[model samples]
Target: MKQLVFGTLPSRSTDQATVTMGDASESSQHELKGQLLELSQLVEPAEVLHAYAEDYISNTQTWSTAKDKKPRLVLRPTTIESLCRVIKYLHDTGLDYKVRSQGFGSASATDVLISLSAFDDFEFYKEEEYVILGAGGNWRGYYDRMEAAALDWSIVPARTPSIGIGGSTLCSGFSWLSSQYGCVSDPANLLDAHVITTDGRAFWAAEVDPDLMWALRGTETGFAIVTHFKFRARPFPENGKLWAGPILIPRTKVAEVAKGIMSMAEKDKQGEMSDRVAMFLYVMRKELLAFIGATQDMLVVHAYDARGEAAGREEFRWALEMEGAVDQTRGDMTMGEVGRLQEHIGELRGTAEAYWAPICLTGEDEISEDIIKKSFGWWTSMLDEPSSIANYGYLLYELFSCKDNLTGRHSSAWPRPVGYKHMLLLGAGCAPNETKEISDAAKRSIMRGPEAILGKTMKEVDIVPNCIEDYHDVERIYGSHFEKLRQVKTRVDPGDRLRGWIKPSRHESG
Candidate 1:
């Protein structure tokens, strides 16, 4: 029998361009082999894979801020059938896979991946007010279309034009519009999804399959691979005013700030004003920045911002007063303008290859003051410690809401019923230079965090809700439906194909 994989550089393709491996004295080579045999559909030839591989390595790669992981294999299938075929091939080979609908940016957390960038299929039916999109299609395209049509809709729109809509909405998806429109999930987001299971069966998910539907929307790519999404969009207020700013509240007042915000949320419920929306709360590095998107102009912010004069002084003053960051004030800006101001924040956390060991315990609660204080202390200490001039930055918080709006729960492949999660995100630049001290400091800061904030009032210092940690819980949570989904995977790609490189549900439970 012939070896499935031949020697490296097995050339095959349409157009030809010869390039030299300039540096090495002699060309290097390795045998090429993969589970291409298990797939039941036509696939890009080995030569195509080799050529694509050559080009992919030569240029860019995809990932979110999630560190230490790069797609072990990046597959760009041209269609639904082709994607399933490739996934089937990978499954039979026992490779773990993660799906990235957008170009992997700073927030991603997987190594082996599938890129839908090549699949640019877009079907827009005018009357439906919705569109079916290939996962890889750029999100900015959709927003621009809506903006052009004068359509005011709010789903999970990416804060960055470059981010992928699928990944953003599916996991911890948040936006400037989150407060007003809720999150990025709802019955509306339940339209339909084209998914490839571990067993490599391509299928659609919706309310029709409630368990699978929920899993697809919330969990990461553990249940199945999502290649297409039917999103929910409706006309909304286009000329909405955006009241956003960074209120430089002293770090010592973090607890007081939390209390004040909680109080405001409670008051808003008790007929404070007519407008409705969830509030934005991000405990950033130096300031606790909060803002909301409103259709109403001349809307009062909170009390008054003592900050000096700015263009939109009235609006800025209102937001500052409400925020109570009063030590000093930064002027308010429109929503679009705010994006520009905050853009630098994204680059502040370490780098692309650094990882933030999540400061979370499975099945724990983070509702105490001590937990908050200690957590902050650990992080602050690490930031102060003598270390590389460049170390991973840490972001800490767990969003608590009643679960409504377009952005529902933090949509991860892993969703626990537990409450008050903390994500100790690590950021770095050079993958190789990210040191152990940096990673350890990040981790140390997290586990001890609860003592800072929760104190004794909190029940447990639990794990973040957005990660696939233990397999048993996954089975328990999904119950019979999970088995059924597994069966579908088994039946479709019987060879046990696409194992790790995007398995059906095998990690912890894949």
Candidate 2:
């Protein structure tokens, strides 16, 4: 690995003393290491180790191999006090640092990485109908706990059980329950949060500052570090069961399935379908589906109805009645069981370099079958590319009834005011040894697939903040809320010490 040079660091003794990375002597590097080690002693149970330490690899693994940037040092802070001290020291000394919860997305620290894995605390107040979740824990553990307790209620969480609660909530998390409860970051679900500011001031955002609280919800950028979340729990349906599973169709029925999905979207818009129903349509190759006993490449409709099998069958009548469709619906399943359906796929994370490009369509826009066919055509063409480095790729369409299910639309920093009813996510993974040029070319092709879907109505598309790329325009992603978020970011973190998925500096010129 190449030696990383992080601009410069000021001396601990005086503000005037500075050491540049390029010119620094061995003594300077030792002095910096000594300072980092002091943090562990300052707070009990905290530990600081060099990046090459044996435990470092296990502590800092992420879902995407592309995010594996090794830092100079790793800091594991066990308590809130330790985290505050670490943050304050980094801010005061003008050091570059990054925070990691689950290391799922693009989280990397060039100088120091603060690992929050020790903050795994969970508490549920049944009488009050709310739950407190630690930032370090993932949704899988939470769901397991809920099942162990045999509780009659549960909170809304991301679809993938491996996703971290803190990172997902901060990025406006979407779930199977979203059609009924909206995103996990919405005010109705995410009541309050325990956060630490850039200067190490710890407080509950909702109690102390409305501006901070608003910014924390869906900004997906550097505002504050949230340690825990307080979410309101919803009553589980009677028997704690719902209808959900995959309905497989051969690739030859691509046009028919696409038309069926569009028809369902129209019914949702007309307020004719139940809000409890949601569907995901995806294209997968035969090789990927072999584990499920499938003999051919397939287009799958993963359907859900919070109401039982009877209602689900009624809601998805068109798809079920279609010719050559295989119904693999689990008669009725608990939320935990529903989540486990995708666990096999989630296990593929970190196996290769991955990329995502997403496009969202609002309720006002009309989606024609022609547009869907063109998008599918683009995806299929890439699978046939002889020299393509994208060994595994899939195109997914997420459909939901948004208008009637969501509440408090203006409460969060999410830019889409009217809310989006349809989302198309294009994902691809390549070998880790692939060249940057080849990987970038594959990403560009994936990005163009969405454009083919939008056709001449491209301007009407909305952006899903969690699925955005570095090349995407900030103005379009944030929409009209860009300036307000910038002001809030500038006020809270004037120096921009913290890093987020979308940096505020990207919009400075606009």
Candidate 3:
């Protein structure tokens, strides 16, 4: 292998492995191993993994069971140039590879994998009110950085701190400020990006390829790999904190809570709710639900706002006044404080298989009482199932309004949020071996209510930016932009090396 220098790290040490090709086909596996080893030497900080290799186990261990794939070669690229070299080599060799960033739903099996954990670079331009970050870091890192610097600004990051910046941003990121400033990936918030096409060409996305930039804002895994992103940050509230907490309602008042949710969403649509405020309704399991103590199940209304606690009460008046209020807590809290306060959700911690399938709704349908009731029943029923208890399967409502004041400077591949009011992210987790069964069961329950009401499968649902699951109807997920995105994919990767990242239509191009 030729020693190449480009990224910050040099090379990783690997222990000898007992090469069992498994289903990789002995001949092809040996050839791929050789090809990857040669390419690995050409890129700084690159590691080529064979099955049973220690590095391969460590690298693939990060993958969620929802789509955990066992690749023949896992390439962990530490720098921008290193990643570019890997892409170029893979494209030239016509070897299929899947790009992984924090490996959320990337469990599909593959022989070649490219990981971006080493590309984490976070920089803040205090005067410019922007942050330049590599694709690898998570929201928690950015928040911690800002806290350390005492910087009073933030960008749109995922609600959870573990989601990678690259995947979140490119997939139309949702943030607390989304309603105010548009999706984080909106051209207005995203200043620019550095990307490498699957063909191995690296350049500034904005300067060299506008269409590619547009396609990336809302799509997953088709066009190219983003190494860095420049994001326009929003100022923190005056107190340097936001007021957030959950408002609990017992089962006795489920109808009232449902009505309040509908009213709040309607008010949001009319531009009545302050953009600073975001809320969602979720049903907790009997264990957590019992805390509020309403003999039957209960719903928890989670809300956040830039305003202080006193104002929060007035803002969430309807929800607060709803009969059967069990318990509530709202206070001004810093990002770091909130992070710590957030319960250490077992499923999100990646201790189990986590699969997310979201359903989106819009217009009057967004407030459908019947849908909410049915969805709640289905969710509660699922929680009562023995598998649900064993697997820690659950779901939640991600209710928030889409920003209407979009600049549209560049086309966003994300489904247009014209009439969409909010979404529901159905999350499920289980032992690795039980992931598929639990995920399917969760979907079955979710479809009975959310899907049936919205008349959209997970494929057609437009929700938050997340790791792509191994579902077959991604074209429906990409919607109107799938064709254009396919064209961009063809332009960037005519060989279709990155096709594994997403499911392909029968006639779709690379």
Candidate 4:
């Protein structure tokens, strides 16, 4: 395996020509496109798509249409050799470029876009108890492959099927198995990565570069383009069959549900709850229950227990037996089925612009019913706004036990606060026509709920890097790790060629 030598490239030439989308002349743009098309012919199975192509249009679309940008050209490289050559060309010419796998984040590029969708390879090693996965595919595809193999084991990754394995893993994946297995990017789970650096050198980060490997784990995508990942596999609990599903309760039962959640949080704080159990509560419009002919505000409790059906039933008995329960869909489900539970909701992508921020509550403080009520109230306010884009949104409370078993391994680049038992995701969605002022106001309003509950201002609260708005302070998100990550960025991506959610620091290393 080849190794990456840090800080080996000479400084970029002062006279190098680069075309940016905003200032490129028509002739320059035409020349750039011609060059890209010619480069595609250099490698087998490589192709280039212009903006007019249907595939190019669809590939550029993102979950939030607000983040979408039209790139001059899209490059699809199936082999590492092709990918390396393309990247090297782009770097040498100082061309602005970005890499996309699933395009789930707010990051966008306007000059050149490299699509990794062709590298969707999967390989399992039964003897080694590990798997090598390509970066291009989503979690749904990976789960399907696992089920097809009929293997009793699976790697810990994203909870949502539509999420890309590469982006999620690199950003510190939170999963149904996270309570038991730390995070997908934890050293125990993400064993290695195959990365292509800014200089276009391909190498296995784990084989010869521990510093780069540590940076790749949860560094949030500015360091390099990771082509593949090597993850440690673990046996699924109870042969991969878990008891999981949603229990829907009408608005009339909101108080009761809040009490149940408070009780669960208390138990979790006391370490009385099993690590195998994970629960999520969603406060949203009753439209989700339209299939059942119900229309009203709804509170949904999605509960999962890695243990068998009997144990899961007992663990979530409060939710099943709660008064005014409109529906109980909990039952035995395979890991893949559980992961796909939210796929229908995910289909709303591209229809609305969304903003997200995370609130993590540590065990030092007791769970507050006031916080739950306030969060629900915010959701209600959004829906009640007449003819407003915020009418369709959700407040999700993710509750799980905290078990820190990966203490000895290298810490993740994502600064996940220690001892956090509850993670609250406040999301607000609006129509594409909504004015920037209104959208910004709605985004600011969502944070007020958590602020009221924690009795602290937004700056005083620690934000998780997993789901953040574009305006979020990067330094605050990375916390104490920001400086170290900046150093790595300066060393590896000094030219800042790769466009990502986080940009490299402007100050160069000494």
Q: Each prediction's TM-score against the native? A: 0.64, 0.88, 0.85, 0.89
Candidate with the larger TM-score of 1 and 3: 3
TM-score of 1: 0.64
lDDT of 4: 0.72
Residue pairs in candidate 2 whose N, alpha carbon or C atoms collide under 3 angstroms = none
Q: How does model 2 fare in lDDT?
A: 0.72
- lDDT by residue for model 4 over 315-338, one digit each (tens)? 777888976675455566788888
Off by over 4 Å in 2: 1-35, 39-46, 49-58, 238-240, 364-366, 401-405, 417-419, 456-460, 501-510
Clashes of each: 83, 0, 3, 0
Best by TM-score: 4
Query: What order do you get sorting by TM-score, best first?
Result: 4, 2, 3, 1
The regions of model 1 sitting more than 4 angstroms off are 1-73, 94-98, 102-113, 120-126, 158-161, 176-182, 198-203, 207-211, 245-259, 268-353, 356-375, 396-402, 405-431, 435-438, 455-510
lDDT of 3 by residue, 130-187 (tens): 7787787767777788778755677765565666677777667777677667777888
Assess each prediction's global lDDT (C-alpha) against the native: 0.43, 0.72, 0.64, 0.72
Which lDDT tens digits does candidate 1 get at residues 1-510? 111111132222333222222232232211111222222124454322332466453212433233424433344555566666556556544444455564333323232345666654555555666666666665566565555554444344545455555655555354444434434444444366766676556566663454566655543444566676766655443444434444444455656655554454445446462232322233343222343322221111222111223423443333455443442323343333433433453333334433333333222333334444555555555556455423444544422232343333333233333322223332222244447665455445444444454452122333322333321144543334455546544444344333321234343343
Instruction: Show pairs that collide, candidate 4.
Output: none
Model 2, position 438: C-alpha lDDT score: 70
Per-residue accuracy of model 2 over 230-250 as CA lDDT, tens digit each: 888878865457899999888
